[model samples]
Target: MGCCTQKCQQISTFTIAAILLGVGISMAILWNNIFINIRNKQLSVAHDTQGFKMWKETPIPMYMEFYLFNWTNANEFMNNKWPTKPNFQECGPYTYSEHHIREQLTFNENDTITYKTRKIWKFLPEKSKGKLDDKITTINTILASVADTVKDKNIIVQEGINFFIKEKSEPFILTRTAEEFLFKGYDDPFIELAHKLHIKGLDIPFDKFGWFYDRNNSVDYDGVLNMYSGVEDINKLGRMHSWNYKSQLDYYPGECGRVRGTSGELWYPPLDNEVLEVFSPDICGTVKIRKNGTILHYGIKGNKYVAAPEIFDYTEPQNQCYLPKGVHLDNGVRSVQKCKFNAPAYVSFPHFYSADPSYYAGITGMKPDPAEHHFYLALEPITGLPLKVHAALQVNILLQNVKGIDVLKNVKSTYFPMLWFKQTAELTEELSSLGKLLLIMPSAGTYTAYGMIAFGALLLTIGFYLMFKKGWKTIHDEEQLLNQQQTFN
Candidate 1:
C-alpha cells in the first residue's frame, strides 16, 4: 500500500512537470512573434530600409501617373544619365531606342492616329530584278545627257529613283537622273545649331559602346529621305527601316531586322539623289542636351526606388501614366531639362519623324513570364501631374505616313502612330536581359505574413516530449532497481 501511494505521487509529479514545460514553451514562442512584429512595424515608418521584400501572390495591373520635369532650375540636377546609361531611364539621342516598360494602359489624348505606312525590302518576292521599259529608257537618256554636263560626273547619285521604277508604275517621263541635279549638302540645319550648343559633337569611332549606335536604328530614325517628287516615289526607294514598305511595327532589332549601325550625326549616305529629299526635322530631344533623350524619375518624396505609387486608380479613365522603369533620382536617371511647350520650326516629313512618343515609356527589357512581371516592371516612381502609370499606353508606336510617296519626298507632318500593347510584356522582353536595380522597402506590417502558430506548436510539442520521456525513464529505472534489491533481500 505504501509503495503504491509513492508511485502515484511520482507519476503525478512527472505529468505536471511535462505539462508545465509544454505550456511555458508555447508562451515563449508566442512572445517572440509579438516582439518581431512590433520591431518590424517600427522599422517600416523610418526611411532606413532599402526595398520591398513582400511576396506578391497576385500583382494586379494598376493605372499610374507621372510628371515632367518643369522646374526651370532643373538643369543643375546632376546624374542626368543621357547616353551615359542608355537604357530607358537615362537620357540619350532620340532615335530607335526601345527600352523601358510598365504594366498599365495609358490612353493619351495627344496620341492621335494619322496616316502612315511602313516599307519593306523582301528577298525579291519575284525575280523582277532589272526591268527596263519606256520609263527606264527615257530615264537613262536623261541621265546620260545630264551626266555629260556635270563636272563631278561620278556624283550623279541616282539610286532610289531608277532602281524602283518598275514597268507598270514608272511615271515622271525621264526628265531627271543622278547626273542632272546640282548636288548640294544634306539639308541639316540642326547640325549647325548643334555646333552652336557646347554639347560635344557626337564623334564615335566605329561601333564603340556608349559612343556610337550599332547601326541599329531606322535609316529614317535620323530622318527618311524621298528623292522622287512622284506618287510612286516610295516604291523606288528602300524604306531603310524595316525590310521594305511594310513591317513598320517591327522597330526592334534582330527579329524583323536588327542590323548594326552608328549613332549620332551620321553623314549622308552618298546622296541617293534617288533620295529626292531627306525627312529631317529639328531633332526635338537634341537641343542643348534637351534634344538628348532623357532618363526619367518620379521618385516619391522619400521613396526613390519603390515602384511609383498609383498616379491614379485603374478603375476609371485617368490622366496618369507609368513612366519607364529604372527612372529614378538616384543611380543616374535624368529629367527633361527643357520641355518645348512650343513645337519647333521644321519641315513636315509627315511620314517617319515624330517627337510625340517622347511623352511616356511602356515597359521593355523584360521576359514574358507571368511570375516575372513584378521583378522586371516594379521599378516605378511617384509621378506628379501630366504623368501616369499605364501598361497599354496610347502613344505613337511609329511615326507613320512616311513610307512610299512620303519617303521619296521626305514629309514631316508629325505623324506619330500612337498605339497600345500589353505594357508589362513589352518591358519584360526588353529588360529581362538587363541588370536590375531593385529597392528593398521594409513593410511596417507584413501585409502578407503567415502566422507562426505551427512553429510554436512544434516547439511546444518537442519540449513536452523530452520531459515525459525523462520522467518515464526515471520511473522505470526505479522499478527495476527495487525488483533486484527485493531478490537480493
Candidate 2:
C-alpha cells in the first residue's frame, strides 16, 4: 500500500509539472503570436476605445513657433545697383500655444469617421523672443503677386497693372509690425482695388494681408476629413479616406493629388513600413517621411522618421508631379501656388536646408542647419503614439522681374524667404510613465513565463530522481531478504 501510494504521488507530481511546463510554453507562444495582436486591436481607434477619445482631441500640449525672415537689406536691394542680392535676418520665434479639436464628428457604418479640424492659437509672450510690435521690412507681397499674375496677360493689362502700382506708389518693400506680418494683417490698397474691379485670376479671399490672416480660431479653414476608425481593420486607423469629400485634390496631378496619409495627429500601431505619410491641410498635400533611426525618449523606445531630401527633390521621377503647371522649380522648392490661390508661394525646409544652392543664390543670411530646420517625428512602434514632433516648414515667394512693371523690372528672380514655423509637441511625464510601464509589461510577461517553465522543469527532475532512488532502495531490500532466506535454508 505504501509503495502504491508513493507511486501515485510521483505520478501526480509529474502530471502537475508537465501541465505547468506546457502552460508556460503556451503562454509565451500566445504572447508573441496572438495576445500581442489582440492587444493592439483593442487599443486601435474604435468607437469606444481610448484611442478614439485621444484622437478626437489630443491631450498633449502643442506649440507653434514662428520664425520670420526679416528682410534686413530690403532698402539696400531696392536702391542699390541692379541685381543686388537681398539680405535677411532671422527674427522672432513668435511662440503660440496651439489647440486642436475634431468637431462635427459623424461616424459612418463603413468604419470611417468624418470630422472637421478646428485649430485655435494663443500667443505666448513669455515664450517669444521678439515682440509683436517690432517693425519688419519685407517684400510687398501684393505687388509681387499682382505682377506675377498679370505678366502673362495682354500688354495692355500689364501696362494698366504697372500704372496702378505707380499710381498707388506701392513701394517694392513694405514695412509692418511683426503682428501685422503674422495673424493680424495690414490693409493693402491693391486688395481693395482688386475687389472693387473684380480682377480675374486675382481674387483675394480676405480684406487684409498676413501670413495666417483670418486663420486663427477658424473652423472652416481646414476642410472636412474622413478617416478610418480602425473598427474593421486596425492597420488602417487614422488613414484619411478623403479631404472635403474628394479623394484627389485639384491642386496637383497624378499621385500627388491623391488624398492619402494620416492627419498628422496619430498613426496605426505596429508600424513596419519604412515610410510614414502625413497630410498637412496647411500645405494642402501629403508629406512622406522615411525612418531615419531609433530613439529612446523617457525610457521608451521609438522610431524616428524625418523628411528626407528626396521629398522636395523635383528632379526625381516620382516627384515630377509635384511641380506646378508651367513652372520650373529647383530640386529643393515645391510650388504650392495653385493651392495658395496663385500667390507664387513655395514650401521648403527652413533656411532652404537640403535645398539646391540656386534657391539661395540671390539671398544672404540663409544658414541652413539640420538641427533647427529638419522636420521629424518620433513614435512608439507598438502603440503608434508620438513621443516627439518637430514639424518645420519655410514659406517662400517667387520674386521675378515682370515686364512693364518698373518697380520689379530690375528685381532679381529669387525665391524670397518669408517665414518658417515649427510645430512641436512631446509626451508629458505622466504619459511617459504610462508608456514605460506598458513597454515593460511584455518583458515582464516573457520573464515570468520562462521562469515558470524553469521551475516546472526543476520540479520534474526532482520527481524523477526521487522515484528512481525509492525504487532502487526497494529492489535492494528485496534482494537482501532473498539472500538471508537462502542462508537460513
Candidate 3:
C-alpha cells in the first residue's frame, strides 16, 4: 500500500525500544539517586541520640576486660608508682571496698601458692571520701599481711577470716559462683555479683589445674578438631586463630560457653555511664556476657580526661580476667568518637570490582575472609588482633562506612558507642543509604517504591527487551526474507 508503511512500522518498533531503554536507564540512575535521597532521610551515621533506644536503664559496673600487656603494665604501675602498702597500712582510697579487700585476700591466698610467701594488706587512706572512712579498712592484692596499721582505720584482715562464710560449707569451694569471683576475689565489694554471672563454675580458675600444656599455654587439645583451635572463647578469652596472636582470654572460642543476644536482646544505654554515672570495670556488669561466654564489654571507656576501665579485671586470676590496662574496657561508651577509629582511606566501588588492597578489612571487625561480610570493624588497636568467636562480625568492615556498597549501610555506628560494644549495631540499619531509606511502615515503603521507580523502570526495560527480543528478530528476518524471495521470483 505504501513504501513508507513497513519502514515506518520498523522505525516505530526501534523508537519504542529505544524509548524503553532510555527510560529504563534514566530510571535506574534516578532510582539510584532517589534511593540515595530516600536513604539519607532514613540514614543516620552521625548518631542521633533521638533515634536510638535510649537506656533509661543504668547498667551496673561489673567485671572488666583487659589485655595481658595492659594487665602487667597497670599492675606494675600500681605496684611501682602507687607501690603496695608496707602492710595493710593503706589499701588506698575510693577504689577499695570490703569487696576489693576480699579479692585482695583471695588473690593473696592464691599467690601464696606461687610467691612462696604470705600476702598481707593494710588499707591506709590515700584520696576520696571512701578511703577517708575511719571505720573502713582497705586491702591490697599485692602486699603481704599488714598487721600494723594506722589507728584511724580498721585493720580488716582475713587471717582465717570468713572469706567463704557467705558460701555454704558443703560446697565451700563449689559455692563460689561466677558472680562471686567476678567481684575480683573471694572479696570483691560486689562479691554478690558471682551469682549474676551467666556461666557458673567459670570461676573454677581454668589455671587452677595448671597450664593445660604448661609449655604450650594452649588448653583443650580437642578444640583443634573444631574450626577454631585450642583457644578459649575468643569472646571471653580473646582471639586465638594462632598461638602468637592469641589474647590472654577470649570469649566464645569454640562455641564453648557461647551466648548470643537474641532478636530483642540487644541493649544500649543512652547516657554515658562514666560522664553521667559512676562505674568500675572491676565489677561484673561492665560487660554484657551472653550465656555462651561472649564477654561483650566496651571498646573504650571514659575519655582522655579519665583512664579506661581495666579490660582484664586483673584483681585475681580466678575471678578477674588478667588484661592489659591501656586495654581497658571500651565500655561505659562515652562517645562513639572515642570508640571508633577513622578509616585510613576510603575504598572505591563496585567493592566487587575493587582492586585496591588497603580497601581490605584490617583492624575493623571485618575479617580477612572474602566471602564473609560484616558491618563492624575489629582491630586489635594492632594487626590481626583476635576476636571472641562471635565477639565481632567474622568478616568485619569499617564500622561506619560513608562510602560502602552494603544495602544496610549506616554511617552512624549507633551500636558501637553503646554498652553492647560487642554486638551488631544495636540499631539495625535496614535498606537505608546512610541509615534513612527503607522503613517499617507502608507509607515509607510506598514512598520507597515510588522512589524505587527509577530502578523499576530499568527492570521493566530489561524485561521488555528480554521478552520481545525474539518477536522483533522474527519480524526483521521475515521482512528481509520476503523481499529477497520477491526479487528472486
lDDT of each: 0.23, 0.86, 0.23
Error in Å for residue 228 of model 2: 1.6
Ranked by lDDT, the better of candidates 2 and 3 is 2
Q: Return the TM-score for each candidate structure.
A: 0.22, 0.88, 0.22
Where in model 3 is the C-alpha error above 4 Å?
Answer: 1-4, 38-175, 179-489
Candidate achieving higher TM-score, 2 or 3: 2
Count of steric clashes across candidates, in order: 101, 0, 92
**Regions of model 2 farther than 4 Å from truth:** 1-25, 77-83, 270-272, 454-489
| Local accuracy of candidate 2 as per-residue lDDT tens digits, 253-278 | 99999999998787888466789999
Instruction: Give the least accurate 10-residue stretch of model 2, judged by summed lDDT.
Output: 468-477
Model 1 whole-model lDDT (C-alpha atoms): 0.23
Q: Least lDDT summed over 10 consecutive residues: which range in candidate 1?
A: 50-59
| Candidate 2 whole-model C-alpha lDDT, 0 to 1 | 0.86
Please give the range of 10 consecutive residues that has the lowest summed lDDT in model 3: 141-150
CA lDDT, candidate 1, residue 461 = 61
Rank candidates, TM-score, best first.
2, 1, 3
